[model samples]
Target: MYYDIIVLGVVVSILFSELTRLSPAGLVVPGYFVLSLHSPMRAAYTLLIAFLALGAEKLLGRVMILYGRRSFAALILLSFLIDGAIQASGIWAGNPGMIGCLVAGILARELERQGIVRSLGALGVVTGVLSLLLLAMGHPVFGTQGVWR
Candidate 1:
């Protein structure tokens, strides 16, 4: 069979996007945010993210993986560069979304290693949903708000 480079490019894009979740920007704050939330909004956001992340990843799996696998050699390298960008952005101002991207990246890598292509997408949705929920609940999993307070 012939190789398709375009497909690989798309997957690399998605992978780079997901890997961004690893940075503090993604997990902790979102988790805290969900915890801080007060009511229905929490559930609504969590569900929204879960659906978007999982649905998008699942739907776009073939396109992303085919492209990602073909260019596997450059995947992690790109992720590292992206991570630096996230940190730099944080230094300049403040970006919680950056953490989410970092976590997504880390989760994507794990999913890939496990041979669970869909896991990346699923993780995206799940984390997205969870982040929203935590934020609505006022948890501040990683927010400036003190959890103990």
Candidate 2:
């Protein structure tokens, strides 16, 4: 079931991106997010970290050149550092782990390319649609109290 959802997510993301000329965060980001619908806080925390990383990148952009592979690598590294700091500080109970950080980094990079509002809007739409489908399928989307379950 999880595998099917992931496959559908990838397909939907690709179709949406091609049709709209916008990325829903990243190709696989929506899938990752749908998995975390049970714990929305986890998604929120990940977004917070991604925003922090974006701010750092903007600040760093002024001091040095950031583009292409360099910018991508820096974002990933910054995400990891931020995730670690958040975990060490116990700022948020949920740790999104490396994959979460990577997704956040990817999303942040897209946010930089496309604008925050648009990027986030697309993400929200895709996530919401996928979440609804998962819910309709009676999956454990927001917990075990789902209608079908």
Best by lDDT: 2
Top-TM-score candidate index:
2
Candidates in order have lDDT scores of 0.39, 0.79
Among all windows of 10 consecutive residues in model 1, the one with the lowest summed lDDT is 1-10
TM-score against truth, every candidate: 0.27, 0.86
Off by over 4 Å in 1: 1-77, 82-105, 114-117, 139-149
What does candidate 1's lDDT look like per residue over 116-135, in tens digits? 44444544454455544444
Candidate 2, residue 61: lDDT: 92
> Residue 10 CA error for candidate 1 (Å)?
29
Q: Which stretches of candidate 2 lie over 4 Å from their true place?
A: 93-101, 144-149
